[model samples]
Structure formats: C-alpha cells, structure tokens
Target: MAGPRAFAAAASLSMLFALSPATAQTPPTESIQIGLSTDAISITAGFSGADLTIFGSLENPDPLIARQGRYDVVVVLEGPPRPVVVRRKDRVLGVWINLDSEAFENVPVSYSVATTRPLQDIAEPAKYKQLSLGAQNLYMKPVDETDSPATIEEFTAALRERKTATGLYSENVGGVQFLSQNLFRATVRLAPNVPVGTHKARAFLFKSGMFVKESSAQLEIRKSGFEQSIFRVAHDYSFLYGVFAVSLAMLTGWLGRLIFRKD
Candidate 1:
C-alpha cells in the first residue's frame, strides 16, 4: 500500500492537472499559487499532525516591488465542516452530569492561518472580518435557529475553546515570511484531529495594507493501508464489524489460555 508521502505526490499531480488549464489562460489572478511545495496532504495511521510548508510567489512583470510600500501575504488552510455537539457538564451529588447541550452546524473541523505581518497591521478590523482573514472572525452559524442568541453565542465560544485546546483551530500572526520579496513560504501545522476530506488552501495578497488579489488550492486527506480497510468495513457493515470484533476478542482469549495452560 502507498504511504502518506506517496499519496501527497499523487495529490500534487492531481492539483497541477486540475489547475494547469486555468493558469495558462488567466490574465494573472490575485498573483499567487499554492503548488509551491505540495498542494495536498494525506494522513495515514499513526499520524500526529505535521508541519506543512506552503510555498508561493508573486507573479508580476514589474520589479519585485512596484513602487509600493510593501506587500503582505496571508495563507490559511481549512478542513471540512460538520455538525458538532458541545455539552456542558455539571457536578451533581459527587458526580458530573450533562447539564446543557448545544448542537452546532458547519463548524470547521480544522483551521490554521499564517500571515506576513500581524493581522492588525495588515488591514483594519472591519476589512479582516469581511475577508475572513482571522480565525476569530470565521463564520460559524448555529444549526438550530430556535435557540436563543445568548445560548448560541455561549455554545459557539465553548466550541471554539474546545477546538483550540486540541490544536484544531489556530491563528498565527506573522507566520508568512518573504524569502526574497517575490518568493515566500509559510509553515502551518495540521492537527491530528483533522477530519478526512478535501481541505482548502487559500492565499491572499495585500499591497500596501489593501487587499489586492487571492488564490486557492485544495488538499485531500484520507486514510490508507490497514486503517483504510478497517474504516471502510466498519462504516459499510457496522453490525458485522462489531460482531467480528467481539468474536476476535473471544478467540484471542481462548488462544491465550490454551498457550499458557499448566498442570
């Protein structure tokens, strides 16, 4: 079976082929490309998240600096979103019990961002919020609109705290750096809790504190090898999988007793 790196290579080629035609005909998009190092990533068994480097460059005919004050780049990676249930536990008579619960919908399973400079220095708060440049300003909506606003906000904060604690969501100011003005790279980490799906990789270019152009790519993360087969079987035939698991445990116990038998 192919390893994670092998999957990464295949994903890279897939992205290249998907974007080749567009890049060839475009009149120069926001001036950035994500295939700098590898556009996609794969998570295999024993995966504990890894530092993925995003390589990009400015595509301009003019001198590296076009009579501008400076250029800033911000790169962000976002995983697929799914409904998340956050429950608040309370102590009741020497035991912890579920008190209140909130169901959130379409929350990012994983998110990370790196910027050339502090987000405040790059753009105004209003601007950044509009562009979704900062993690704190991400769009999160409640699935059940019947819930009260206060309750919804509380659950949202709780959800953010949980994801943050597990390194699923992050905000790294000044993460992007210029290698030589035109060429630059940003290092972002993928969390072990990242869900398997097609994650998005986006890069935004700012010229003298104003948003100029942007580009985006896709990253595919999936399970491989034994893990893949096991996951497939479990989800496809849950009842059978459970029975097999139980049977295997019993057989193992029987064999252990037989092997260690003594007079």
Candidate 2:
C-alpha cells in the first residue's frame, strides 16, 4: 500500500509539470509581406493627386504581442533614381543669382512614407539611420566628395527642404493600420507632380520598437490619355518633336501678330 501511494504521487507530479506550460519550444520567427493589386498605375491629364493603398500580412505574429499592440509597420514609396543639381541663390547687388551648386547622383525623385505611428515612437533614431528609413535619414551622395562636410550638409538640407516644399518628400503618420492580427493596410499620398517611372514600395515590420523584417514590391507609374502620346513622341522622336515645337512657336507668334497687331 505504501509503494502504490508513492507511485500515484509521482504520476500526479508529472502530470502537473506537463500541464504547467510549454516554454521549451521556440516560437516561430515573424516576417512581413506586401502586395500590390496591380503592377502599374496610369495617371490621366487631370490627375491632381491620389491615395495608393497597399495591403500586407504579418507572418507568424505572436498573438500576445499583437494584442498588446507591439506590432508596427512602416511603408515607403520611392520613385526612380535620377541625378539632381541643387543650386543656392545668393543676393548679389540686389539680384538673386545661382552661386553654389551641388550635384547629387541616384537621388530618388520622390519619397513618401506611411507609418502605423510616428517614426520616433516606433523606433530609435539610430535604428532608422541604420535602415535609411526616412527622408531626413536618407543618404544623399554628392558628386564632389572632396567638398567640406559643412558644405555638403548644407546642400543636403537644402535639397530636402526643396523636395518637401514641392510635396515630393512627405511623411504620413498613422497611415498604417492592422486590420487583424496578421493583416495590415497602408495608404500613401501621390503628389500632384509625382514623377512617372518605376517606383518601389517597401514595408518594414517592427516588434516592440525593434526592427523585425522587410518586404518590397515594384510598381510602374505611367502617363495616359493624350499626355502619354505626347510623352512618347517627345522621347521616341526627339528631333522631330523639337522641329515641330519650334515651328509651332513661330506659327503662334505670326497668328498672334496678325490678330492683335496695330499698324
């Protein structure tokens, strides 16, 4: 009877241990994915601006962490890279003239950011600098690297200011929202003067203010309607387009003189 009682006590202890929790097995690693409903977007002649919606999913998201609202997402839409020349105007004899110029290569024509929360609240500034995640943190390579750091910094700031003023560089806080535990949506603004080219859409996942995963997709922005035809002609037939433009200008001048001239 004593041996049987001891055996029963041991069995009960083992069962309690098993029921306590399963903490040994590692949780699955989380990842992020994004998709575009269409690979291309067409803008008509009257396009002022619009919102582009991006859908994404969080894979292997921890239910507890998600419930606690630790998951965050940041989405970026970056336009095609192009060389830009930023010039500074100095007042010379009361005339503002271009004085100092800085040329930057491979600069994104447009940059738009959308985030679940403010960037500062989501991650540290150092983390964002490491990831090059924001317009302010983006590195702009100057053509002349031999210049002084102060000059480069000044020009870089100027360039960013110009881009922001034109609505080419923007940040939209709270633009990303989690529809469910693992699904999310982001809306990014397309400026009226958004460039037409291949744009990259990227999504970054953060857990508890730490960067977790990243995903990206490509999107083509093209012109449509009569504007598209003109754009194609200007590029595909540059010589003929130039001739036609000059002839049209001359013809317009002649017509205006004939209609409104006083002799």
Candidate 3:
C-alpha cells in the first residue's frame, strides 16, 4: 500500500536518475511495457475470479518535458463476449409479468477500467472513443434486425447498469497509481462470473491530454482440475454427458431407497 507521499518521493528520485549525465544524450522515446501478474486463470467448482495486478514502466523520454506536465495512465480490461437478454417486468392485474424485452449479441461479459484520473480529464470523448479508453466507447449491438437506435441505446444502458451492479463492468478513476515516476501499478478484480476465454487488456499513456503510447496483452481464464475435465466432456460429448448424468442420478436414488427402506 504505497501512499501518495511515498510515490512522490519515488518519482522525485526517479527523475534525478533520468537527468544524470551518464546517459543523457539518448534520443527521445515515448513507450511503455505492460504485463499481467499471471498468464492463465484456472477455476473449479467454487471458482471465483481473482485479483490481477497490472504493472508497467513508462520511458522518461525527456525528463525536462515530463517534469513540465505529468503523464496519465489508463488501462482497460475486457473479456469474451456472450449474448445477453434484458427484460422489463410490470405488475399486471394479479401478478408481475415480463413486458418489453431486448436482446443483445456479442456483449462483453466483463469490462473494467482503471485510470490515474477521470477519463474525461485525460481525453475528450472523440479522442477517447478513437482509442477505446473507457467503457462508454464499447459498441454493444442489438441482436434484433430492425431495432430503433434509441431503443438500442436504452438496452445498452440497461446492460451496463446490470453489469455494473454485478461488478462485471466498472470504472475506477484514480485507481492507477504511480509507484515511481516511470513505474505504475493497477489492481483489477475480475468478477466471479467472468466469461471463460481469452480477454484483452490494454494500456494507454496520455500526455498533454492526448493519446500516445499504447500496448495490448491477452489473458486466458479457464476451468481447471475436475471442473476443467467436466467442462471439456460436457461440451465435446453432450449426449454422452447427459446419459451419464441420468444414470448417476438413478444410481443415487436407488442407493438412497435401499438404505432407507425396511419392512
């Protein structure tokens, strides 16, 4: 838990090294190296998504220029897509019943973002959309062939609200903190129901309120151990899996009857 004061100290020290004459004449380079804490995430019966720490280094291309204004770091992590359906239920004469409904396809199962500051302060909407820096820029399309744009927008907003409630979609302004002038770290907590597949993690470095260096990484999340085996068999041989499940159920029932029955 590095505090702001500690980070400021580190930043100051880092700047000193950058300014020393040992290697001061190098060409200016604006770049970043970002990576995840783990390459793969495995799940089991009680599996819940885990906390992932993303860290990176930003090259101090020119200490003089960097000192003029601080750089902002924003990271966005998005998971595999799955179709979602949102429904509205209204209380009828006697009971509540579903009324209007909308279907969305290829929707992000999980989306989380962390930034050094508010995204708006980092970049304008147009620039942010171009770089896809925030959750608002993600394109979620309606599955219906002829839905009105306004209706689609309504559904999209609902989807975001639902996901946000479940911690699947989130925005943490000032979540990213600099450990040193050149180093940064952000912690992303994956939702327990995060989709199992490859996810994309992106980092963008902004200076002077403009997009600059950017990088992308991939994260793999899958079931492991017995859970992994069951998932594989169930998907690859659904018929066999179903038959086996029924047989197991019957066997359990028979055993229960034998143990309890007495005359």
Against the true structure, whose TM-score is highest? 2
With a 3 Å backbone cut-off (N, CA, C), the pairs that clash in candidate 2 are: none
Off by over 4 Å in 1: 1-30, 36-40, 61-69, 261-263
lDDT of each residue in 1-263, candidate 3, tens digit only: 11111011111122223445755666555776677656676665465556566887787545555665468888888898889899878889978899888998888789889998888887789997676556778777688959888878887788888889998988888778877667788766677677789988788888878777998788887755776688889999999999999999999999999999885
Reference-based lDDT, each prediction: 0.74, 0.85, 0.75
Report residue 162 deviation for candidate 3 (angstroms).
0.7
RMSD each, Å: 5.9, 16.0, 6.3
Measured with C-alpha atoms, the lDDT of residue 96 in candidate 3 is 88
Please tell me which model should have the higher lDDT, number 2 or number 3.
Answer: 2
Candidate 3, residue 205: the lDDT equals 87
Off by over 4 Å in 3: 1-29, 91-94, 144-146
Estimate, for each residue in 84-198, the C-alpha lDDT of model 1 and write its tens digit.
8999998999899998998877877898988877888888888887886667777677778899999988888888888889999887776787765466777777776777888
Candidate 2 lDDT: 0.85
The model with the greater lDDT, 1 or 2, is: 2
TM-score of 1: 0.79
